[model samples]
Target chain A: MSDGRDVRACLGVCDDAADDPQHRCHPQHVGLRRVGARPGGDRTRGRAGRLLQASGRVVGGVSVSIDQRLVELGIELPTTPAPAGAYVPAVVSGNLVFTAGQLPFVGGVLPATGKVGEGDGLVDPAEAKAFAATAALNALAAIEAELGSLDRVTRVVKVNGFVASDPSFVGQPGVINGASEFLHDVFGEIGVHARAAVGVAVLPLDSPVEVELVVEFE
Target chain B: MSDGRDVRACLGVCDDAADDPQHRCHPQHVGLRRVGARPGGDRTRGRAGRLLQASGRVVGGVSVSIDQRLVELGIELPTTPAPAGAYVPAVVSGNLVFTAGQLPFVGGVLPATGKVGEGDGLVDPAEAKAFAATAALNALAAIEAELGSLDRVTRVVKVNGFVASDPSFVGQPGVINGASEFLHDVFGEIGVHARAAVGVAVLPLDSPVEVELVVEFE
Candidate 1:
């Protein structure tokens, strides 16, 4: 049903396509200005602006456009999930892994939202930890779906933990501890890696916490 | 020529040796904070502190005491050159390449330091660009020295450019353009990839700018 023009335009935006040199040279213009005005000044608006800016600036290369290749292989990018508050979408490096941010999606949609270690009536720390564990499980499932196997993982190098905090909730580390513990239980020594624990005002849909992992493969 | 005690102490810090997880987890507590307070005041201090805290804390994985396997093979991690100004060390991903921050070092020491666009009085943009290109070349050299081949590269994904700036420097993009242009010239389309142009207050030892790359390889 598509015309030649549509195919060419798609190729132009595709990650796997040969990109123009001018386009490849500049892929993102991320700077402090994008971080935006602090404290409840519409975080989604800022995030959208930044994401558009990043996505708008094209970087051309074989792998720089990996997503396009996936499409060529008839794959589709999953929708950006509601990060159970407090984390990043992905991190990149050469010949390595960048993880998409994760969230607790019950029945493919966000169902739980609250602050850990706070008097949030919706979720307790233990329950929140369990939810984080579930979110991590979801993240791994997503990775497996893309890469086809967990066997390629060489190391789970870094974890970024985001906890939807209630200012007084000082146990963000402990809440995310469940994720670390689960990774070790799954991958043993390889899962033991570096991490960062972060506190955020609110996550997408006010989910309690979100976690992402960087998995290295051989 | 070292005393028995010094040798013993050195051996103790080696990976898979007798190491106290707690002690190594607090490098700053042991006064080994290599990057510290710059003239930027609290923000810089906070960033440094966070970086230090996170760097030492090993959440899992048989402890971070596992040194690079290359050491057992008798290979040494080269003294990586510091960024010329504000920037990060590296970004990582899955089964490919992520580069550590790289600066130009001659015989393992910094021989040049300054902004890329002005203030240090470099005349032509080509000269400045060429120098940045050399720094990227040095970065690849470090990667080769560590990983053993450029052929393993699947693709170059992103190059983060950090330029030491003069207030009048609007050519930040142009100066770093040298690195991008040269990388493509060196590796063809595979070398051409995504990039970010960043300006910072200062870099380590005042080098013109620092270049880092993300490469994908088989």
Candidate 2:
């Protein structure tokens, strides 16, 4: 049933329903709308299109406003962080925004360093989990800067969590839960996403945790 | 310019242009079409939408079909490999398809093992490059299984290359080029993508190289 015409038609239906506050188009339609909304001449248009198109599916029945949820949780997105390398902090392709791997930096400096699950003189997994949350916040900040507001986001598509770990560390998923939990708290159901938690030899700047996000925006 | 009305208008334009062989809609619109074309209520719709959306950004003006390129290169997609863990080989959400980390397994067995940059007794970096390519092929096989054909794909959005490296190894990017080069040869410009080359402490199954893909398809 997947063919070009059907998707377009579905999106058209979604467009017609746009005025109704309770109307929920499919996530794919929302993604298509996001992609089509951007100016076509922008160099980032292609990338934005590709990202958003893939993120078209929206979980139905979620009416909670993301902004209100953040406020309820007393969360404030931080200022966007400067890139640690030559890359831009995030790029909008089609309907999706992909962020660079963010380090657990608080105000331009890493709060802690070394491998997770290591003994003394290294980062504890618990601490690394908190760091992961910080890194996720940084990623959200980058998204906010790119899209002008977090409310534009439709879904958190994917999260790639890279944990620098001691040789024996096997709790990479647990460490990344810090970021996942925080996202869930902020976006509720829309914050739910696919993820990869990997243990790495080291990370840039020796940071214990790094987090990146693929977010779908409306 | 990225507002719901603008996006809807853009997609409408794309739908009107669909019958023209040379017509190219904005990537997001194309992605939306792909997602909408899929049969509704299919369990994989969301995943399919996610995978296909990121792939909407086709390299415009390249007339060579992906199938033609594969034939020119004498490439044959191998059988889909079974996942080694609890995860499925690939998952489609929205218009995007994501593959689990794929190992260089031939007939369900790894061709080589050990770290990428280690001395003798371990897989050589050069050999690991080849393994990376093999792993990439496995990822493609999974995509093909999910989408039924590689032709449905529009772009290779992002590739994450994980190399199990010796402590002193520093050529992770070079090693991953094996997979990148092979993908480019097969998909040409559409295969060009953002990538991360990482050095890891170890990988599942002790394989020298592991590759995962985030692909967009129609």
Candidate 3:
């Protein structure tokens, strides 16, 4: 059941819970680095020693650069998805960027369809949750496309998640938590955001979930 | 069919179109006073002549104060609805405020409860549009409660509209126009915003529409 998604919301403190399904991250670091450093943190074997790179250092407890954080997590962001219709994938006004609703488009195709629920002709909630994380990752792709880089973002302000449901299903929050927690894992404290999760009848392209983001950048 | 809703999105330039079924507002005023001011704008009956009050007036061709525009449109912001769960109705950071998803609750009750679509046992798209407008207005009430005055708003930055649908409905954008046109009617050019409208399976309290807003203020 492990998605192989790491759990750095608490840094290395919860390394054991990273693969355990029972533990979920809700970081209280508030965009600050963990002051009580663990000294010997998990080091990537082939990151070219990026931990000591100029942009990845710890200073005054500010969080690490998001680019470096992505490297540390062993994740490579995918290409920015193209808007399917009249709208652009994302728009920047002032310091915030607003993204269009994004489906879980992995390599240009939604991974699954149908309402999320138990039983026949339905998508499992666990699968939908994973899709939500992928959808949030796509939103970051859109933001990067608009602002030229992910390093400009200062906060993940809000995530609006919609889960297509079978009407009787009421686990919308649990499904959306996948996106919320993924942000926390990436941005540390700055990833903590206000969110709204809801169930909807259907979505464009019949994708199981749709996600949109409002991000604040410098 | 008129719904007694005004068409001040054009600043009274379309008074007859207010009740005409053929015309819908797509104001281009951009929150500016129509420079070619139509000779006489509509006057209010009991706004205590608020148009000439200290806070309302023309300035460098920006736009009339939102309060003055609301009086001109004959709308009273409804009482802010209580959040249905553990979240507050709105939160602010920096110069912007983000509102929670708001259901079209009139007097603490949903006027209709069903997926929006044609045929039997569905919520009509037209009715759903009006509900979207009401939900956006409710979001404003939450903003007013948090900021003490809607007058602080400088711009309606973005709107995220969710229309509960029957899985076959594709009128989500038309439904959301109900809220969009209403905001334009009240805030002039500043009301224009980037928006994302999506059809979902259902909504909380079985609401046909749920709307949320991101607003920028002075």
Who wins the DockQ comparison? 3
Model 2, range B35-145, lDDT digits (tens) per residue?
111112122424333333223234343455566645544556777764432123565667898776677877677887677775766678767777887888888887887
Superposition error at B1 for model 2 (Å): 26
Give per-residue CA lDDT, model 2, range A12-120, as digits (tens).
Answer: 3344332221233332242122111111212243433333332233224445555654454455666778898899999999888999999977778898888887577
**DockQ for each candidate?**
0.01, 0.07, 0.10
Model 3 bad stretches (over 4 Å): A1-62, A67-94, A97-101, A105-110, A141-151, A158-174, A192-206, B1-22, B25-100, B105-112, B117-134, B145-148, B157-160, B166-201
Give the Cα-based TM-score of candidate 1 against the true structure. Answer: 0.36
User: What C-alpha lDDT does candidate 2 achieve relative to the native structure?
Assistant: 0.64
Return the candidate ranking by TM-score, descending: 3, 2, 1
Residue A6 in candidate 1 has what lDDT?
Answer: 25
lDDT of each residue in B39-120, candidate 1, tens digit only: 1212232433333223321323322221321222122334444322111123334444555445555445545555545444
How many angstroms is residue B195 displaced in model 3 relative to the true structure, after the best TM-score fit? 7.1
lDDT of 3 by residue, A6-101 (tens): 222323443223222223233221111211011133433322232122123243467567777776655567787777789898999888899999
Best-matching candidate per TM-score: 3
lDDT of 3 at A87: 89
Q: For candidate 3 chain A, which ten residues in a row score worst on lDDT?
A: A29-38
Q: Supply every candidate's count of residue pairs whose N, Cα or C atoms clash at under 3 angstroms.
A: 28, 48, 11
Q: Once superposed on the true structure, which residue ranges of model 1 sit more than 4 Å away at CA?
A: A1-218, B1-95, B119-127
Lowest summed lDDT window (length 10), candidate 1 chain B: B30-39
